[model samples]
Target: MPLYKEIVCNENAKLYLWKITEEIEFFKHAVLLKDVSQKRVDAMKSESHQKGFLAVRMLLQHVGYTDFDLYYDAFGKPHLSDGKCISISHSHTFSAIAISDQPIGLDVEQVKEKVLKIASRFMDVSHLENLSDAEKMKKATVIWGIKESIFKIKNETGISFPKHIFEEEFNLESKKTIAQLQFNAKTENFNVVFDSVEEYIYVCAFEVDPNFLQ
Candidate 1:
């Protein structure tokens, strides 16, 4: 498929997603990769991984960027030449990137039963209370994405999902939530939005503005 979806996280950030239905060649032919990205893709051992990698470039091109405009820091956080804060994520058959004037992070994951199995390891299982089996799986995936999105925004060492991040209890229908991160003697809050496309759950996160929408 082409671009799967776009998210307006806030006035300052936008997110793009790609569904990896086409073969790897689709991405190779559609997007121009700088040499480093070409070399990285060449070394990928899995075609799905290569497609996922290239799919990101496809998204970059979708947003007027190329591999040439993206770079990584020592900690491997992605930066754009124009100084926009950018975050990238892909899982299974989906890939996503968030571009923001402010710091942001995005994540996508296939909805799978396995997330429920390990839900307790990373999120507050109490929030899963009251949902049926199917809802449990979906909610668990959302919570995991919330934590992962927040972690990517923070991008700091020693920030364990189970130890430092917490999602406020929320009804699934809300489609958005507030989460907090407690690390290094500080507490920071984030605003998160999540939704499902086909069988995948995608998340986008931004630091909460003091006047954030209630």
Candidate 2:
């Protein structure tokens, strides 16, 4: 399939999602990969990973971009050669990328019971209280995606999820919330929006103006 969904996050940002239903060879023959990306794709032992990588390229092409227009930093953060902020993520059968004029982060995680089991490792389990097992799993996955999106925005070293990123209380129905990054004796706030895509939770975070949160 082509673009599974397109989300206009704000005046300056957009998110594109791809559903990976085609065979690996299909993507291998479809998108053009730069030397680095080609080598990286060729070296990947997992077909799933390769498909996800190529699907990302297909997404860039969907948005009038090519692999040549993208690059990565020493920290492995992706950047557009034209100066747009970009974030990429893929899980199992889906892949997604977000482009923005503002600093942004995005994540998509498949809803799975395993997130509930390890909730304590990355989030406050108290937030799960009163929820049924299924809700707990869904909420935990959203929280994980929140932290991951923030981490991608920061892309800085030593930022731990449980210790540094904190999500404010939010209900699943709200589909939006606030978060804070407390690290290095400084604090930053982010605006968060998320939704369910098929069985996955898709989350996007943007660095917010301090006054905007008030």
Candidate 3:
């Protein structure tokens, strides 16, 4: 499949998502991977993972970027050669990338009942109260995305989802929320935007700045 979804996040940021429907060989011939990325793809044990990896390159191409324009830091965080902040994520059949002038994080997670089973390990259980079983599962998945997205941006040592990141209570109907990362004796706020995409939750986090949400 081509671009599955695109969101103009702001004047300086955009998000792209791709649905993985092509065969491994199709993508292998469509995308040109660097030597290290080729080795990484070759080392993947699952065909699904390899497809997801290549699908991301397809998204990069959609935005007039090629694999050569991207690079990863020592912490595995992605960067653009032209000095743009970028975040990448993939889950199941979907792959996504977000580019911004400011620091950002993006995460895509398939909504599954399994997330509820381990909710307490990463989130405040009290926030799950007064909700139906279905809502519980959906909300839990969003919270998981919240933590994962924040971690992707910070990418710092000693950041624990359960111990350091906290989500402020918000109704799912709102389709938006706020969170905080309290780590290393510092606290930073983030503005969160999220929505469901065909049984999957897509979450994007932006650091609270003077121009944020303006």
Candidate 4:
């Protein structure tokens, strides 16, 4: 199978994208299979999940981790034995993973019109205003990705939408944005970067620290 492009961010995070060209057998060997159910196992036959698993495994190996033991926390967030923070996402035919020394989040979405229907659920007035006519559809998906990343970092579920968690708008020319998470009455902000590939967009956000993996 051919691997898609891999990007290393300035904050010591590694992102890997994999193009789905192999059969389902590739997923059977994934490190994430420990607690997965037969139904989830059957679901991996879908190309998107397979590619996502491949990307995640690649990042796990790159970070000097082997032995695929993934378990969900009380809130349903995936956790690893090592303290390394990790996140995984998948779009139609592409999957991506992000790993860093600090907690991190990553998301991948296929550009689709359905994202527009639920924009209000996750976006605020200012975020909506910043989007242009051509970008309106994509804006919600991006927001969803940002929120997913935040949830992974926090390892908490049931967080509210953009009103509770805010992301600063940046021009498309600028590939990065800042987001703030307010939960349990405390707030913390972090930087997030995004990139556009063939038919999908990928996003990654994490805490800022100098000691990220080089």
Top candidate (TM-score): 2
Q: Is candidate 3 or candidate 4 better by TM-score?
A: 3
Model 1 alpha-carbon miss at residue 173, Å: 0.5
TM-score of every model versus the real structure = 0.96, 0.97, 0.96, 0.80
Model 4 TM-score (2 dp): 0.80
lDDT of 2 at 211: 52
**The best candidate in terms of lDDT:** 2
The models' CA-based lDDT, in order, is 0.89, 0.93, 0.91, 0.69
Task: Give per-residue CA lDDT, model 2, range 29-63, as digits (tens).
Answer: 98999999999998999999999999999999999
**Deviation from truth (RMSD, Å), model 3:** 1.4
Tell me which of candidates 2 and 3 scores higher on TM-score: 2
Candidate 3, superposed: residue stretches over 4 Å from native: 209-214
Clashing pairs in 4: none
Give Cα distance to truth, residue 90, candidate 3, Å: 0.6
Worst 10 residues of 1 by lDDT: 205-214
Q: Write the per-residue lDDT of candidate 3 for residues 8-91, one digit (tens) a residue.
A: 765767889998888898999999988989999999999999999999999999999989899999989999999999999999
Report each candidate's C-alpha RMSD, comma-separated, in the order given. 1.2, 1.3, 1.4, 3.9
Off by over 4 Å in 1: none
